[model samples]
Target: MFLKGKTALVTGSTSGIGLAYAKALAAEGANIVINGFGDADDIEAERKALETLNGAKAIYSDADLTKPEKIEEMMKQAADEFGGVDILINNAGTQHVDPVEEFPVEKWDLIIALNLSAAFHTTRLAVPYMKEKGWGRIIATASAHSKAASPFKTAYVTAKHGIAGFTKTIALELAQHGITANAISPGYVWTPLVENQIPDTMKARNMSREDVIEKVLLEGQPTKEFVTPEQVAAIALFLCRDEAAQVTGANWSVDGGWTAE
Candidate 1:
């Protein structure tokens, strides 16, 4: 329980990688603030479960992250409840698949606001608390798209690329504060969201299930495997360790060598 008494705030944490990040931190005894939209019952269940991970406190924040004022309120709640976030994981994101010409302008704005700008809001709000303590961890769930691009995903790609640069800049600024800022870039992570798309993809392309997964999905992943949420969370956990104090401004790739090409 190296993180006992610390607090972690994870955006988009109701499920998938975000939830995994929360669970990992909770296991190490960190108080938790989970943010995202989900079934109320499910969110509460997860929140209750987190508190039991190591007898730490856990709360839920349904803050609409695209709104800066809501982000501020959420941060204030964290401060009021647990002395502010010691670890901030900017993981809330959404995806829209379409050519740039056909992409909805509203979606482009939302992607930029949620995936990119929300990180800035959370980081800016949490930095003061961290600076006061002289210790903190900031991790962003950037994607393989952050390093390599794919067609029909202009907004997502743009936002992720922005995140890579944002992570680097903040890392340099916080380096002397005993804080580490890093981004984790994972490729084709296996989650309910990814799993749900498989059936549709298989039917659309007249491909077998295995073909959809291997050829269509894992095409760029040299290992031909879906990176698990736990794997990405492990890297986040490592970044919070005292040993990683100097490991800032890095884009840690858990992408099965997708960007190695």
Candidate 2:
């Protein structure tokens, strides 16, 4: 119960890595506010799953994080329900794939809004409450692309790089306020988004899934395996600990040595 009295807001938590983080925090006794843009029924189901976890109270706030106004409202809803946010996981994001020359302007804009600007919005809104309380943890789900890059994902790579810079600046500004801002960069995590991308990549290359995984995704990774959400969540939980007060403005990578080379 490291987070026994903390209230955590995990955006895009209805499924995937976000959901895993919510569960991990709940296991440590953090009250969870799950955020996602989805059907009400799906949201309710996710809320129920979180609630079923012992020592955790789960609530849902459906908001499209790409919109600033909606994100503000979601923060208010979380604060209202959970008292105040002690931990914020900025996990809501999307990716678009296209050659730079052919990339749609609208897609680029949407990627920035969701993956980068959403973090800015949430941090700005949550900072005041955190400052008032004298303690807070802000974790952004950046990507290995933040440091490296892959083809056909120009917008995602750009947004992730922006997030790294954003996290560092916020960490410096909020350090004196007992708030820590950091980013977790995961490589080849086997989430739904990644799974979807696998098929698309396969289609593009006219290769089998196995061939794509072995020749493409694992080509740069030393371990040649997907990093699990649990692994990433464990690091996230550690960053929220009182012991990690001095560990701000860092990008913790769970990349299976993808960036090591």
The clash count for each model shown is 0, 0
lDDT of 2 at 115: 93
Write one digit per residue (lDDT tens) for candidate 1, span 123-159.
9999999999999999999999999997667888999
lDDT of 2 by residue, 1-261 (tens): 878878999988988899999999998888999987667887788788776776588888888888899998988898888778899999988876667887899999998999999999998889889999999999999999999999888899999999999999999999899999999999988887787777767866688999888998888789989999999999999998889999999999899999888
Those runs of model 2 whose alpha carbons end farther than 4 Å from true positions after fitting are 38-42, 203-206
Report the lDDT of model 2 for residue 68: 95
With a 3 Å backbone cut-off (N, CA, C), the pairs that clash in candidate 1 are none
Worst 10 residues of 1 by lDDT: 196-205
TM-scores for all candidates: the values are 0.95, 0.95
